[model samples]
Target chain A: MEKTTHVTSELNINNIKSFLEDIESFIFDCDGVLWRADEAVENAAQTIAFLREQGKKVIFLTNNSTKTRNDFLHKIKSFGIDCNIDEVFSSSYGAQVYLSKINFQQKLFMIGEKGLEEELRPLGLEIIKNFEKTNDGIDNVQHIEPDHSIGAVIIGMDTSYTYQKGVYAHKLLAENPNILFIATNTDPSYPVKNGKSLPGAGSIVTMIATSTGRKPNAIMGKPEQLLLDLILESHSLNRAKTCVVGDRMDTDILFGVRGNTKTLLVYTGVTKKEELPSFEYQPQYDTRTIGDLFTLFQKL
Target chain B: MEKTTHVTSELNINNIKSFLEDIESFIFDCDGVLWRADEAVENAAQTIAFLREQGKKVIFLTNNSTKTRNDFLHKIKSFGIDCNIDEVFSSSYGAQVYLSKINFQQKLFMIGEKGLEEELRPLGLEIIKNFEKTNDGIDNVQHIEPDHSIGAVIIGMDTSYTYQKGVYAHKLLAENPNILFIATNTDPSYPVKNGKSLPGAGSIVTMIATSTGRKPNAIMGKPEQLLLDLILESHSLNRAKTCVVGDRMDTDILFGVRGNTKTLLVYTGVTKKEELPSFEYQPQYDTRTIGDLFTLFQKL
Candidate 1:
């Protein structure tokens, strides 16, 4: 990989080329820029192929905590893109890393689905269901009381949401306000097929936070510096070389900008073209569309 | 009713007695103190009966926008309490009063349900329903756009929520940014049969405010002082002799304290027993429970 250092206060075409030269590793956001609503961007496969040919490693990063790395890899491969499970990083995995580093010892009360449980199980974390039900005699469980032995409460999207879950989370949160309240991401809505959408884990997290007078300790996803730091540490790469590409400015572009990496704002995602000027912080490169990625790669 | 005034900063039994003696009109809050999880308070019926015998005027004041005055009266009567529709005041009703006073001429783009419509329709206000169905491509209406001619956008809880509504609201908000965004209440959650619930209008209203970067022009509900002013204006009652009795310190008691009415905190609502001392503005009377209201009346 070519090593070049270029810095400009604003986005320019030359800086984009300089970024590609210096960065041996590329982190691409999946939801909006690569594939939106169920359809992959026209140049997604070509861009990935060009990156592989250039001897540059590509990692698919997603804040969608609903899917596992293997699941994501399978989905990407089906879209005519080649990626292994190890090349994909999800917020659920990042959350697991966060939990392992903390000194929580209580039974983990999770407000998430199977993907989250799959991530936390290997850490020897005990899952406690219905803390309120167990305490109120509605259900029988060994751990009825909340004490130091209770580890932490993790929140994420659960399609099978119930009032009991909220009640339990509220009670556990109230008991130990210091207990870890970790959420996967802060995205309020997730894109669905047929132009429909569902409230993401962040909405539930907000509800819990508002009910209890506490905020999450850490959000293990994009826009949070922790995940970027972890990726950098694992790859043994400096921030100057890595280029972050995504569709949303608030989350993806923000991650790159704040992480001191070259940021590319692709037009194939959640954010619209008209909303760019209003942003306080602009991205390093503003491509008309992600289809231009192949043209830029050819020029480079 | 006694017209005794005790101007003492320190709270004592003598002052509490004096304050209680001066209470001719009583304002009660719904949800928590009146009922907990669909169960009416044990003394609710008897207390209302005793107040009626004393020939004291009573009003049921609530920040809950889900029900109309008739709905509340019916619900209260179902719970074995005698109450009139005229004696109930809601934030929706307050919004109607505010809108009528402003003399807005154009049709209203309402983001609320039946209760809100019922309150606004009597004032000859035209309710714009097409904003709610923008996704269906029903663009027959000439004034589809939310402009200066489109008087205001009234926001309240609507079970029929959609992204299309959000988009239309955003469009109107972006165009007129000055167009009124009136929210019914700011309570983040409402007590349900199970526990505290989400999808409250407060969350939706907050989302719109955060997205548009503008606070609503006014919140016509408890704690806003608008509703209190309306109550006093309609009933021709003096704030000095009016006692606001409710379970929530933040909403009911805060209103009373700010409006210069005698505030009473009943320990049967959103606030717990231990949380009273932490409040910056204290209530005049802190009863152990709503049952103590009868005892307070007896003492007076």
Candidate 2:
């Protein structure tokens, strides 16, 4: 394989066991490492249970903005994995926390799904408009001048994305240079069933960026420090003893490198073994799957 | 007052007669110079008629894509100006000629008003979809995958632009890297009635560029050399003897500068005297208005 050096340099079972022994807390990415779409990866549930049984703090972190924290908790529980709502750190959840932390008081203009709205609405944050919820006929479309009341623009993935929404957001940002612009995640696309993918939140965010010529102040997702900071905030996580686990090298491994935490790459998701050399940054450790980590637990 | 140097150095009425004596042909930008919105500028008609009486080859050009050549001729006639339809050059007309020059055989996916479609259809070109003509209920929207038959994407201003239309164009360009990407113009916005403006073709084009990460191959409008090329192609224009007259420094004057044509800036619309010095390139001549040129004709 092209990545022979990195592949052969991976920690052996004994080395992995020693590394696990030093880890005081763990952060796990939910999608590719533990489950694909609606199906759980083989032995993934048991592997997490084994880590929890060892008395290590565990948290589920994901960049998927389509789901609320409760939705993630429900999905995680159905996989026979014990996940509290507080342990979930979805991008929408992270956005909610970040907005609250900054004490954002103005009306939030959004180009996102109901999940994102659900996260912000309960906190008493006012949204400028919800096109999907309005369900107005296309004939009812009207050109509105820029409204000065809009204070921030937040974007997430919505199956119902429209040009009118893009225009309204663009006009607002163009009129007010100080508006707080934020995107929940910038993943190029997300995998669907049958190995197909749909344009992700990042693509939608890009549309807004192209229109307004402005980048988001914060992208609340993996590889961005905001999510990591939120995960460690409540848990009092020690970066030196924290191990971040995920399937993708770009989002997960790079996330760990940036945070100074150990990272383990599982092959059950996006990245392949042969693709390692192509990346400028490599994971600290990589194995066949999340279940492979069980060997370390058995040895302990 | 800020542009005093450029203004003072500009040819006076006596000097203007000498300058006009050498001009064999002229390309005139329509809006803001000869007219503002739907109203003609004072003496604009007589100035142009005087130029024609001097046996000068004159062409009426505009970057506005909302009108066809016939539409322009009609508007010009309404202004009490004798103009031939063949002497009018609109962004839509330029796009039609460009596609024909390239021998384009595949269907064009358009994001524009009916005027754009009207120009291309007469040239035996087929359009993929018209967002306005469909008149489908917005609630009945469905996602259709990229169609390979779409060989080019052409964008202009469209009040009916939808997110679905933007995504479809993006997917086509993303999937087929070689698909000819073209836009009518990149004017940030177009002026409407009551001194207001709305987002223009550039905004819609920017959305696709942001989504696909590709700039247009040909933006068929002012400030680009393509339009100048089109103007000169039929007339066998001598760049040295050709004079370009307009009101805006950014588009019209810049177009002339880039094309190596002598340019005359009229202060009737858009660019004010204070804004001229900010431009790196200056027009060769400046006057109070287009009617000021008629004074040169009278002196002769």
Candidate 3:
């Protein structure tokens, strides 16, 4: 649990001023709000520019584990929004921070892509290929065995995943009760080519967690507070001033409500307009679309 | 919904005699009562033989979709039990029957292995690779597609599955609101080479069904009356003379309750002995073990 303390500028007037008066730093959800299914939202770049002119610091946050921060920054730039790599906060980075905090020492068995591994390596954790690597007397080719030395199991998206991996993870979890389980995100689906979607790492994490009866220690993405805490920590921003603005209520709005930050729901991404009135926790600001936020800001 | 018709047989003696006085046939759950995992229960063969000697027809019913009727028959024979292939009933067989009843024409996008597909082919249903295969120039692989042309979506055990398969299933389900969703079994776990496991086809079916908001048309496996109906249809066995004996309450005892047949719970498999007395629905005859049932029959 991290303390929330960011303060927004009182003199700033945005079009959504009536709803988001005290908001300063903006946290944007990448997948749906900023861009959707390989297409950037219309006027998305201009709106980001307008927010920057208003002296609001922006952070691109995403629960998607498939793409690294550098990859996301590149994609965001391609979408016509100028953003630095440091302004990106991914769930994978949060996972690394979480692992570092807990001081988990065992060889990591990652079920994710290279980005996830890159984040965890800074903590001096070695990634073991398989459970066979733990075996001491094995004369065979490079084998990853679970020798009761591994400290935690980390799961992320791996397209080449197999049933054997799940079985091995189950075995390791069953063998070591103290071992921690960490997941990057819990989004069930991710965008693919031609507007199609694929089952993300969340599905695999769900499978392993459900089977082992061991809930993950933490999910480092939006809807979870880990990434938000890391963002505030890195920028020395107070939580109250830093409002999370995005499209999806489950991730963006929930993150705001959980962190006690003002939330702005933009109807430009995954969430539909009709879904707002029924949300359990209402957002501080509700705009017809993200592009509308720019017009509202100008009026304010 | 199926009718629960109480069946009675003359084999019930003393305190249990009245319940069996009118039973003419016997239904037995294969997995637990007849066999544990892949091992046959001791004297289980003799008990079925004795029931046959008493002019009681036996139906070996199971919810496990990994094996077909012929496979079950051979396995039973190897355990020294004489069972006809026709006497065995599986959920896959029932799903095929359900599909045939509706005159399904389009190739089935089967999410199962060879056994499930083999069962469906005899029903004149064509088997498509996946929803991706239907991507002809006309279909266009868009966000929304029509699924009325699809005959059915049959799900079963698929160990060599990928995320793409799940995505395709999700796409097909989203496309056709009226497409039939059929699952082989609802067993959460299956016996693997190591031990009890998570995610058989039933688990996958559950995930897809939950996501799509569609209930399966019919589950033909154990605990469902469809398999029982098939057994009764094949053997011409009267409901009044049949009894279902097995270990698992949800599958075996519930099957008997649904079919209105006598249920004998043999404590030699999945269900533990301590769990019997507190069960909400009590089996007609509670044997200490499967061997005890044969000993009692031999004494009679």
Candidate 4:
């Protein structure tokens, strides 16, 4: 394996305070950074509080499309962290930002649950008056009629994902070739309750892409600059002062790098300590856990 | 897009006779060639009857893993074509063929319906006493406890496929990295009815593969010689004298090409005439429909 090309700096007491002082905004990725599954990461809540106390912009920018912005707020709040609805930015929220970008007028055919719908509905985007009521008794056998008004197909993490939903999305995309196809995020699987994981929207997005023989026209998640752009545009945070702390390198670190923001990698989630060199994108600073940052700020 | 590298010859009155004369065994893809979703092609039954009269050993080889060999036999028989149980080969059959190759002792964790199970159950391969009874009430949130007895996980097309199934498959493959991950076939979509298509086993297979971060150890379906190998070994058919006819290039034609059998492309299914020149794999003979062949053999 090729060695890491960039000089990967390990955060220490000597270099930590000075490097941290430059960062005004802290964009943390959830699931691994602040919490994993339902449990909050130890001292991670304290670290966020400490940053906020120091007048730093703490925004939870996540590629996980499973929850709405409000749901995300509740989860973080339950963890004893004070969070506003505005501070939460999910891949699901990217649909609103992306749809408004194209000035999309027609209805959207979605392959996601309430999280995706909740985010998009706020933008006055019609969701095509879909499933649950439509696909009541019959689950997979019910054939969804093609709605001519559908202009785009947006896919995100769906717990109730079925073959019927996939096939319908495939049919709509196939017939209406010009429709905007956008993927919320493409994280294969997110870390769940145990060491186990659930399939992420990326898996579903890729499955459709594989079958449809077409990739998303625009990816609305991290590493693609959409979610970060949502954060930047909404918060009006200076890119130079924004530091993205995340668990995965492909999404988190890469997202920060693409947005011209500083990146910090934590090891409590997907990306590990030794696996850092193997990744193409190197972070500016990396620590074993977010609690390590808590220790530094505690001493200060 | 670049033009086709090889000269793709169209089957005509002169070339068709010569091409038809060279082949002894006829391997037909059922979905597009013989039938399309419970309806038989216009003169496809007559074509099969005509070929059989000319002493051609007819075989229906399909990448569709949704049906067992017996189910396939019944479907063809229902279409007024003579077909033996041995002549019908499906991608699901590859599970039995592949298991016997590995001499797989432990139980299998399957992600398919009765057709896939029915095929493997006959092989005396224990199917881990799977779902329907277990995941009865809860659909997506069913927490399936892992069975350590599982030695492999095989997937095929399933209408009742859920997100829970995808997550479980991802979990199993993740925990048991050494498990034999065999995909029946990886055709993205298959035509069902009303010019629309259903998501193929390939989509589900690809979904799990994406989430698991691993590809199938062996793909049992078309383009891979496993299904064709099963047909060749069981029937003792000569590969050189065999001609494989189908609608799709990636699966059907590529399967024949890889198996060292003559490939004939028909436009009755997924592959179109104009799209043939763009495909990487070129067939030996191209016809508008299988009926064109019936016309040639009708005179004989």
Writing each residue's lDDT as its tens digit, candidate 1 over A191-279 gives 56544345557766765676565789889887888888888887777788888888898899888888888777877777776897667
Q: Which candidate ranks first by lDDT, i.e. highest?
A: 4
**Ranking of predictions according to lDDT:** 4, 2, 1, 3
**Residue pairs with backbone overlap in model 2:** A163-B163
**Candidate 1 collision pairs:** A23-A241, A106-A149, A106-A150, A106-A151, A107-A151
Please write out the lDDT profile of model 2 over residues A49-139, one tens digit for every residue: 8888888899999898877889889999999998888888889988899999998888898877777888888669678655442222222
Q: Which is better, 3 or 4, measured by TM-score?
A: 4
Per-model lDDT? 0.71, 0.79, 0.69, 0.80
Docking class of 3: incorrect
Worst 10 residues of 1 chain A by lDDT: A134-143
User: What would the per-residue lDDT of candidate 3 be over residues B191-300, giving only the tens digit for each residue?
Assistant: 44323453555556755664455677767777778878777777787776777888787678878877777777777666776775555666666665666645654455
Off by over 4 Å in 4: A1-5, A38-42, A125-142, A297-300, B1-6, B37-43, B128-142, B297-300
lDDT of 4 by residue, B1-300 (tens): 222345668887678778878999999998888888778888888888889888999998877776778878888999899888888888888788778877888888888877888889866867853454333222335366567667888888877777777766777788788877889888887665677776778889999998889999988888888788778888898999999999888888888777778889899888888887677768888888888888865665
Please give, for residues B37-57, the per-residue lDDT of candidate 2 as tens digits.
778898989988998998898
Error of 2 at B217 (Å): 4.1
Please provide, for model 4 over A1-300, each residue's C-alpha lDDT reduced to its tens digit, 9 standing for 90 to 100: 222355778787777788778998988887887887778889877888888888898898777776788888888888888899899988888888888887888888888877778889877867853554344212245366667678999898887787777777887777678987889989887666677776778999988898788889988888888778778888999999889998888888888777778889998888888887677668988888887887975676
Score candidate 1 by DockQ: 0.10
Q: Give me the candidate number with maximum TM-score.
A: 4
**What is residue B284's positional error in candidate 2, in angstroms?**
4.9
- Where does candidate 3 chain A have its weakest 10-residue lDDT segment? A135-144
